[model samples]
Target: MIEKVKGILAGLAFRLIALLTLGQISPILSACVIIERDGKILLIDRSDGLGYTIPGGIVHYSETVEQCVLREAREETGYDVLLTGFVGVYSSLKRDPRFRAVALAYQGQIVGGTEHGSGEGSTCWQAPGDVFGHMAFDCESMLKDYLSEHQRFS
Candidate 1:
């Protein structure tokens, strides 16, 4: 089917990009946000076949990490989010299989915009517990850390 082919092509593309840039490139800096509402979390079913990821992407050179988080959230999830708190920075070498990457994660609340999907993936709200094992590229780790931080405070 077309969707299957698309997934294959996307996975191949992701692998190729990773192989082509690995080690040759410096640490990839990206930002993501955790948005929880109505006892559910916002998630993306990635088109790259890289499993589920939160609303985020690589930080543009033109923007700060916070700005990247906000921009990525709006672009990928169709929601303008307000970052309420900083979760933590995740810099594990194996965080992303494609390359060594660093991430700035934040806790966000939806402010405006209509919900929809983009080229990255489809956005959906699901229980945090239901999504634990399906996350991609260290996203589960990010979520766990965010939950731990929030629980400690709340």
Candidate 2:
């Protein structure tokens, strides 16, 4: 038994040493979601440089999920949003073209800001069906989950 424990500890130490030598791994993180209200969804065009995507952005190192969501919404849409509930979490290795990102999705309601465009794309309210049809990523699953939650609660 002592020999087996020693072997396990040695194996763990070797793995730790190898991992430390491999250098730091960059973490890709983001917070976003399909903002829905009444029967429409919010969509935006990227202001940075790319195809149209849902309104959201990367999660800064020192920011909480709530803070990141609020900041991202305000930066991209020029409006402050009140997130009501969590929709889901998406962690696809290839979700972003440049890096892997784990996204925290939320169900939000707009409390302020006139409907306007900002960021890389124009901001507009689209029909729920149309929004799904034109989504930039695999957000339909998230949207579906949101709808399911609504039905379950309602």
TM-score result, candidate 1: 0.81
Per-residue lDDT of candidate 1, residues 73-123 (tens digit): 999998999999987778877787655678888899999999999887789
**Number of the top-ranking candidate, with TM-score as the measure:** 1
* Poorest stretch of ten by lDDT in candidate 2: 1-10
Q: Model 1, clash count?
A: 0
RMSD of each: 4.5, 12.7
Query: Evaluated with lDDT, which candidate comes out highest?
Result: 1
- Number of backbone collisions per candidate: 0, 7
> Which regions in candidate 1 have their CA more than 4 angstroms from the true location?
1-25, 150-154
Spell out the clash pairs found in candidate 2: 45-121, 46-120, 46-121, 47-119, 47-120, 47-121, 117-123
Q: Rate the local accuracy (lDDT) of all candidates.
A: 0.81, 0.67
Tens digits of per-residue lDDT for model 2 on 1-154?
4423543565466456657868354445678756777787776754443435667877888998789888888877777899888877776655554444577788788889866675356787776666565555556666777777842211
